[model samples]
Target: MHFQFDDRLNSFRQEVRDFVAANLPAHIVNRQRHKSFAPDDLHTAEWQAILHKNGWSVPGWPLEYGGTGWSPLQQFVFNDECAAADAPVFPWGPRDMVGPIIYTFGSDYLKETFLPMIREGRHYWCQGFSEPGSGSDLASLRTTAVRQGDSYIVNGQKIWTSGAAVAKWGFFLVKTDTSGKPQQGISFLIIDMSTPGISVRPIQQMDGDDHLCEVFLDNVAVPVEHLVGEEGKGWTYAKDLLDHERTGSSYIFWNKRELAKAREIASSETIDGIAVIDSEPFRSRLARIEAQLTALEWSVLRMLADEQTPWHPSALASCLKVRGAQLQQSITDLQMQAMGRKSLRFIAPQQMADFPVSTLWPDYLVGKTSVALITRAATIYGGTLQIQRTIIAKMAFGV
Candidate 1:
């Protein structure tokens, strides 16, 4: 297969770059450039509406379901440009996760009601799969949804839900039967975030951002129609959603851009009367990271090229997740190290206005320390590094 972007794909990429250059808000672009994401509800809505209007909201999906129906390679090209431009991260629940599930399994009525909302940014989604005790071993999730007449009463807690605090809806996996195997008794259901008996509480992270939440379902009632597919088949559907999630979790573009920034910092600064870029050790590190990034780009392209195959091992998906997470943290660590004592000043949100670094460095470096600290969690979310290693062992090694 060809590795080069076709003329059509290149044109699309250029269009995306131009659009982002012209329309992306300064605040959002600054956050992205600085590796900080503070998503305002109204601002995010406006951004997504612009994307939807331009038909760039759903590049990876089928054309019939509001997607652009671009080739996989085109999707890659578009996302690369968006990331480089520091465009708002797509609300993955709609564009990447639940939308696909709905189109693939939900009834026509469900699709008709949800797909348009998803495409138009009228609805936001959160994945309710991992419970307090069930993360890597997702099959152990204990959330229960017992059928009662035409509805199912869900009862349990979901932890680390990324956007539950602001989501309009949540698609969840609940135990419908305990008599069967752990993986067999599950069913996927969509619950409105405003439903009675549902509670959402934010969890403050180390970076001082409440980006994740704990969701409590205390007898929350959901209509039977919210069920996406056949009962007791959520395990299969969850796997599909996760496969989609893992593929994107590589975050290659973000990492590459950060690496470039690191090199720029190195070239601009001097240590002991020598530029960091001229130092042999720092130069060697840059070479290594650049080589790895190059390899990862090609690996992602290979995955897209092989999308026609069924039951592909997804070895590269796991490999890239592991490597990318590690490299992301590594690059941030190097940046912190390069900054020396300049990284020590941790500015809280309240103190951002008076921050001294504003005079010393560009606005993009204001939150560098915080961003580096948060990258520590990259390997844990989207499935832990250990779990990804286990997948690699089984899929790549035939163990």
Candidate 2:
């Protein structure tokens, strides 16, 4: 029932800030300051390694699994400090998302092999849950894995898989039985990206990044040991993984930092003759966003504080995801407003990749347009806004 950070949590937050200031490369911080959609693979690797060395890589996990054993509030503090310090986005799938599912449900062999790799950031892992026809309707996924002795032959196509083009491993949901209900026949399996029958074609996003991909699995053989939990139980596991994903989708950290950036941009620029920050309309918008952000911050804290509140965790997550996705776009739109015509100075992904921050416009302007455009997809990716609304209706209200 404590509403404020204890001294221990306060000290931990300061340590995180100090460590980030001391260890994160200057260039990495600069890209982050400019609101880069995602840090390049190189920076992600190096920063994760530094965090691992300091025993702070996976703050939300249990200590036995190489986590910091920090309380939920401390984890929040760490996330907040990292965002404020402009640190690279943490690797979620490998460290938090699938990692938990693996430890809690995976075999000892799966744990022994993957946990160390994840903890050390050795290989990147991507989610393979959303097939072309089965995004929010995940149980309709057509990917099939037919068991044959020691391995299963997997065949299907998965679209919108982030980092699939470069990831080494994937956690997937494949149909193991079609006789049962739609949600009853699925199985969770981990497939190697290097498997011979696997092919990954990058999908060029409107924001100009080729990270999202279409993965075709043609008779790809996966070891049976890679299956998580048991056959005909993947629906449960996928639900668990997604529940964790939706909680983080609230995006408290991103919202907080972007709101600050909007304020910064407003204060620095002028509208007509006065500063944008000084204009009444601009001030009003900022106030509204800040108010919403504050309410969201409290909602997240409340859910994190006690999972057994009146609302089910999934229902709470849906509520947060809906509001959070909306706020993400709104903040970005306001940022676009703050940049004014400067937002129109579009920079190609290749240009940003080839040149240093200085070679382009000022640091603040480097990736503003790109992030703003990509934010338009925020509501679509993580169980779209409309879908989240439906979930809230079903879970929070009996209908």
**Against the true structure, what is each candidate's TM-score?**
0.92, 0.95
Query: In terms of lDDT, which candidate is strongest?
Result: 2
lDDT of prediction 1 = 0.81
Q: Write the per-residue lDDT of candidate 2 for residues 1-399, one digit (tens) a residue.
A: 446767987788888888888988888786555544753666777778888899988777778888887777778888898878888877578887889999889999999999888887878888888998899888899999999999999999999998898899999989999998999999999999999999999998777777888999999999999999999999998788777675578889989998998998888877687888988888899999999998999888877676467776678888988888899999999988887888998776666644455532556667778888888888998788888888888888854
Q: Would you list the clashing residue pairs of candidate 2? A: none
Which ranges in model 2 have alpha carbons more than 4 Å from their true place?
353-360
Q: Per-residue CA lDDT of candidate 1, range 70-89, in tens?
A: 87787888788877777766
Q: What TM-score does structure 1 among the candidates reach?
A: 0.92
Angstrom error at residue 335, model 1: 1.9
Model 1 scores worst on lDDT over the 10 consecutive residues at 31-40
Clash pairs, candidate 1, are none
